[model samples]
Target chain A: MSVSAASSRLPGTVAIGRRRVSVELKQFFRDRNSAVFNFAFPMVLLVIFGSVFGGQEVAPGISFAQYFVAGMIASGVLYTSFQNLAIAIPLEREDGTLKRLQGTPMPKASYFIGKAATVFVTYGAQVVILVAVGVAFYDIRLPSTALQWFTFLWASVLGLIACTLCGLAFSVVPKTGRGASAVVTPIVLVLQFTSGVFFVFTQLPQWMQVFSSLFPLKWLAQAMRSVFLPDSAAAGEVSGSWELGLCAGMLALWCVIGLVLALVFFRWTKQGTT
Target chain B: MSVRDVRKSYGDLHALDGATFSIEMGECFALLGPNGAGKTTITEILEGYRRRDSGEAQVLGIDPARGDRVWRSQLGIVLQTDRDLGDLTVAEAVRHFAGYYPDPRDPDDVIDSVGLTSKRRSRNEKLSGGQRRRLDVALGLIGRPRVLFLDEPTTGFDPEARREFWTLIDGLKAEGTTILLTTHYLEEAQHLADRVAVISRGRVLACDTPDRLGGRERSSARVSWIEDGVRVETQTMSPTTVVLELAQRLGGDVPGLEVHRETLEDIYLSMLDDDRDEEAGESA
Candidate 1:
């Protein structure tokens, strides 16, 4: 059928990309445990961190709870986007679902869109969880100004995109679902630690901080912290500028590279791998 | 329909090497081959699933290699794997997929045609294996496809179900739907195919009517009969002449006489064996 005519009744479009997204969403909700892990695991991590560092101070100025809340929220950016992609993409590729869809008239890019859509929803859930827990337990207040909230919101969203791109890129290398955790878990933990997802970036060594800056994690964390914490508090977090625009630029660059790698190298079959 | 000199490979392994074949507008062409003999690669190429390194192939006057989206709407593919629709009833999944086609068969009619009406409302995952196969056939047909490619369509089917599937295929053939079946079941090919092609090592060894395949039908008829408490048999091209001579000798009809012609399976297995022996000798 003509693409136009074929899309006539497409739930979105019969494009393989749209089909992939829909099926992912369908299966995502069907597996209650999967949804729980995607949406709830971060909160569980939040509780653990919150209780452990409840009264202690990470720095002379920053309360452990305050610092870790933002760090945990930033980790949501990785957990929601990266964790989802790492688990879903390789599993789908292994299960022959990708191979099955290749036979259709759906374009290759459509599959990516489907994957991105699921990550987007999962991230949305993570955002709600992060904000709810931060406010309820840790006193991690929302920005006083709407503009600050917008900054936090946009920064958080951008972080998700960046991590998602990295995740999709990461998924292309794992040969099987078992290897997926091995491939994704380590890089995620490294990025998490270096990006200040679990600790204060300022306390790390100068070279370590520089290396962290090279990644989008630190940028996303710094930008997000600027909104979630008081303006007075962020003064101790980064430099005068913190290169906010450069942070966006670098993240966008990773987004482009990750996307390109995902598009080019991702194999739906073991045909070549085998 | 034509697939001209197509070559497809995955990594170091060549799947199809300049494989060429064609089917007419209203012909049932059976692709007979042992497992992993490149029948699937060729079919996938025709279905516009896999890209070939070199070839010019066409289905219904449109080149499958470059067939646009509209061309695919006219085709149907029955996969070996069944659909995985958990909650949706048989009618629901069929109705859902039917919406994708520009011209879809009525879901109810397709269900009935596949003999699934009694279980139409039941959830798809609850159906028996045979019923599920019927559902797959129904889904393949719901698109009102012009050229239906059935890959091992009757697989996992019991004897009765196999016969029913053949009848369904014949019904589709009567409706002028050009059916292409790739099967290991020689009986299925003998019963359903108007022309059968035996493929080995990514090449077509022979393509002809089942009756004429390997000269099985016209080569000779083997006749066995009872005479004087003993059984006698003769192999001759002219069975009627041999029967007449035997009748004269016995002074009546040959008792317990039976004439046998080689089955498609016999010829196919022998052809495959010969190809293997030749390969062995050449390797040695």
Candidate 2:
């Protein structure tokens, strides 16, 4: 057969993207380790922390468990969307799977869209599960009003996009599949610890607080807090404010910056000399 | 596919130093060489996976350096290393990759063609080396590619599996798929390729049909026989003339008469040795 005859029959981008999503989702579900880590791990952490410090008040009237719920949700988004993608991309490249994909007719955008869809679905499920656990087990309140739900929706969307893009960008850091976890795990751990995922943002040291505020994780957590916590709980945050606009602005900025970084750094194959 | 004056350099090392070759449609051409002989460099260039520093390369009438998804869709590539899709079954992986192409073969048929029907449901990670190699071929063929690139496709296959793979490739060739293969296995080149290009040190020493490669057919043949209970052998350009003279002297069938031409491996080894000698002289 001639190349033109074959090329003329190439599948469209959308069809390929949809198939890629289904394939990626199937692969994700089959891997029990990743499924549990991305979905159950956040809820497990929420349970562990919520049980230990559920009674204490972090803010004037809000209990520690209620305050921590927002941060945990934020952490789940970052871990499932950003951290997972960052680690998976380099590992795939190292293992020649990315090269195989590159050899196909699928466009690069379709691959990323498929990956983004997988992250969004996984993180959406994580949020639902974590919120259910918080409301049932920790007596944490859900987003009550239309405005609160609206804030939650945009915050989750923006956070997921920023994190996933950052993850794609960071894929350049790991040279091999074996080194991906080593490179990505510590960064995730440090981000979680310092970005108020585990502790109150106001309580951390000034320098740590300032440093953490610069990252998307901190802004995401603060945004989530504004949606879930009562206005009175704002006193516990830095600047004694919810800073919803600032939160949205920072995430938007990160989205733009992360996209640019991913485009510049993301490679389908490992660096070859020739 | 056509490549002319292709050159790729990594730092001070020239991976491909002006190597050139071409393959006609429906032809199975093999780039035969040893490890580090730039067989992969040439294949990757044609596969559109890597860019050459300086070269002219056109695969399927398109410059591989600028090959897009549509161009890529027409090509099937099986890399030397295995591409395991984590926990996906062989069938699942094949089916998934099939969706990437416009016109893909039936996944089951492709799996069966590679003789992986029994292990279709088995996770790719669970497959043995040879089985995994078969899965690679299945993935490569699922797209119904016009041009296929097999890079050391049988590297990990057992002898039986290797022979099975040869038969599978024979089927592909019979269907008129344009195939460009690279291998260190001379026998594989001899068995599969319509033409074999002997590459060494990033250069094509010779490119011709397997029987004619390195002038193997015209090169001196070794004539051997038993004479008065003692073995005798002579290298002669005309084995027929030598045998005729031997028969005339013996006045009957020459005892244990045997005339042997060099195998493809012998010619290939000599080409590599000649490369080494030239390198040694250059260094001196």
Candidate 3:
């Protein structure tokens, strides 16, 4: 088995990829700044929003805190996948990490896989923490049925994939590590406010609703609402009913777009130096 | 490994213009050059990190442009200056790199070879500049590569540390690991290289053993003597003839007779100066 595997053209690809993921995760969590920003910031946002508007009802028999939990979870996935990656990737390129890895025998695809895995692990942890806080502090409701829980899992997976790919693609927008946050933060903040994460979709202006529909975050928010909110609450959506199928389709389309963009934009090193 | 007629350019500035050289297996070859002499450009092209606009480069019978991961596995490259792996401890970083190779040396042994065993548990960010460079060497060596490329490997090392590094490299050479080194330090080349190549303005000015580079062994020697309470110096292709004549003329012992052949540093500087003058004349 060892001889045959060694003779193959791409030997030990999976084993090396696993090693890369472990190394990437070790580096990511060891950095205090990344730990605080990617893991804790979203929880803080959820709490402040819950405290300010926890009691009011966005729909009949549904409290604002319940509705906001679904939105917060969706945006939290975006923060872990998109915002974190956009900053980390450029920083790696600037600091010679990518260049160092490029010289080694590790396969090129393994590097991106390592980064995606880090994002997934961090996103999973963030979700658990946010849900625990919502249930304990604000009495937020979870999916009540097996099918509802299945929707939550699938929606989270798709949303995370789309957001992660978008983050990798946007990594090239910043020329240096110092410019990464300045370039990526405003785009994420604007999307969150427009995509019904901070406010109800129908409550926003008509132009904002149309604009948010073009992106994945709006669909992610709607999918989370379908899981947590009662069926009657769907009447308050722009279409007056839950649109789970459309949400899945839109998120999947963004996944394709994001993958293409990432392939096109990703570079292993800074422009001039080898 | 060999490079022939390799040329690369950025707009109007030619980074490498038809630079050519070759290294024999198990031979320690040092590339000596002033800054911006295309040494880095050529080295990067050979390492498969940069593409040449036009040239042919072969390492271990494989074209670097077409080198795959398997091909890369056979070579080790130490970059000039890198701040990577700063978050990981020295041992962790070395062990992590060791995983990338098919057959790797023991990470702990490699770390000890680079003299970082005491700092094994310390984060790379806390290492001094010289220590960080040693870690880079440890990572490069962990793969037990057949050919090693070291780019200014001892830039930040003090004199004692540099001597230690030389001993380590000498051991690798004895083990038949081919080394292609680029450095600005002439004494380093004289000590480590079996043959040295001097590059200037993207072209090789001279290439030979340390004793014979720029025809140092055959060049004119400066012969000086004290006569009539005055020092007199003359350049002679044969210092022995001059010394014998001076002794005979002075009757007994010739006062303060000195014969000086050019040092490696002297020849290297003059070669660069001559290349600059030639380029200046052409442009003018």
Which one is best on DockQ? Answer: 2
| Candidate 2 CAPRI classification by DockQ | medium
What does candidate 3's lDDT look like per residue over B84-201, in tens digits? Answer: 8888999999998888887888999999988999999999999999999999999889888889999999999999999999999999999899999999899999999999999987
TM-scores of all predicted structures: 0.85, 0.94, 0.93
Q: First chain of model 3: TM-score? A: 0.94
**Candidate 1 on A186-263: residue-level lDDT in tens?**
877897788777777877878878888787777777777666666667567667544567767877776777678766
User: If you score just chain A, what TM-score does every candidate get?
Assistant: 0.86, 0.94, 0.94
Q: Best by lDDT, which number?
A: 3
Worst 10 residues of 2 chain A by lDDT: A265-274
Q: Please compute DockQ, using alpha carbons, for every candidate against the native two-chain complex.
A: 0.19, 0.63, 0.48
Cα lDDT tens digits for candidate 1, B2-47: 8777887778776776777778888999999998789998887788
In model 3, what is the error at residue B200, expressed in angstroms? 1.4
Per-residue error at A134 for model 1, in Å?
4.1
The per-model lDDT (C-alpha) reads: 0.76, 0.88, 0.88
- Fnat of all models, as shown: 0.13, 0.79, 0.52
Judged by DockQ cut-offs, is candidate 3 incorrect, acceptable, medium or high? acceptable
> Quick one: best TM-score, which candidate?
2
